[model samples]
Target: MASRGLKFVNIQEHSDARGNMRIVEVDGGLPFVPVRSFIISDVPTGKTRAGHAVSCDELLIVAQGSCLITARTAAGLEEHRLTPATGAVHLGPGTWLMLSEFEPGTILVTYASERYAETRFFEDYVEMDR
Candidate 1:
């Protein structure tokens, strides 16, 4: 399901005795070429992160463990539970995101379409000029 510009993508996974592996590529599971990437982990239970919006597109993948992601936009509010098997979620520019309910050892990897810039982030959705 999709809300506003947010999309839930199911990436193809290959499994074997070695373990499981999933690949993301431009125009594939990932919609754009990423200029930056980051990993988030060690979040305490009941804590939240990212209560704001950005001017760049991003893809969030729960590489290990799980977490709950809530996104808000002009359209409405949507929630998703992300696990390794759940693939990834795409967040477009100006979409507000709040992540919480993190299980221990949860590792979230994010790919961004733009370079990191503090001015590109907005705490208030209404402040976005878009």
Candidate 2:
């Protein structure tokens, strides 16, 4: 929830006889403009991906399939199930994330406020709780 500064963005979908569409923009609800973007797809069953804490915020969107994202921070830990309907989950700085229990053909898209920089990321979860 917003209490932890974590937000679940609800995307408005427009559907008709033709197809369905959803529009997301910087000014819509995102706190910051994304400078870098990436996608995770075809994750094997029982596999997991862990990410370190970074200086910038992140927006994770489950474009396809489904997965559970657990994020830990100084405040505590929060888990979110992202789907196409739920849209995206926003994590602020100093948050460590772990992705697991991915369904077949699951596709996760991530957006970052800052450009990719290895030096800006830390894998030490303990340090992030400081």
Candidate 3:
């Protein structure tokens, strides 16, 4: 399944008569302070995004709808179905991640420990596995 470097974190949710909210913080919820963040949405059906690995850590949240995430690990390939109810997944270095099967209007929110740097990214899964 998933590499030990990848972990799932259930973000704390606060709900009320108004709505629901989740809290993400350094040393409290998130293990590290995110210097960069991004959102993935509007992914077309049958399209898949793969071959991305970074040197730092990553935290992914299913903000809306659902999607499937697959990561390569030493043990084998591990797959996870992510929905707003499942919370987030924290992936450390050396893990290859692929995202697909996104429902319409699905939103994926990502937080990274470091800012963007071409040198910090490895497009090859083999390079990341090392």
Candidate 1 global TM-score: 0.87
Model 1 C-alpha lDDT per residue in residues 1-130, reported as the tens digit of each score: 2225688877778899999888887877578889899999999878988878757788999999999988776677778899998888988887888899999999999999888873275675643232
Ranking by lDDT: 1, 3, 2
Report model 3's TM-score to 2 decimal places.
Answer: 0.87
> CA shift at 33, candidate 2, in angstroms?
0.7
User: Candidate 3 — which pairs collide?
Assistant: none
Choose 1 or 3, whichever is better by lDDT.
1
Q: Tens-digit lDDT track for model 3 on 6-97?
A: 78897989999999998888878787889999998999998987567646788999989999998876556778999999989998876778
Candidate 3 residue 6 C-alpha distance from true site, Å: 0.9
Give TM per candidate: 0.87, 0.84, 0.87
Off by over 4 Å in 3: 1-4, 126-130
- What stretches of model 1 exceed 4 Å from their correct place? 1-4, 126-130
lDDT of each: 0.82, 0.76, 0.81
> What's model 2's TM-score?
0.84
Tens-place lDDT per residue, model 2, 1-130, is 1223467776667899998787668988877899999999988889888666656778888888899887776567778777887888888877777789898889888888888773276675553232
Error of 1 at 39 (Å): 0.2
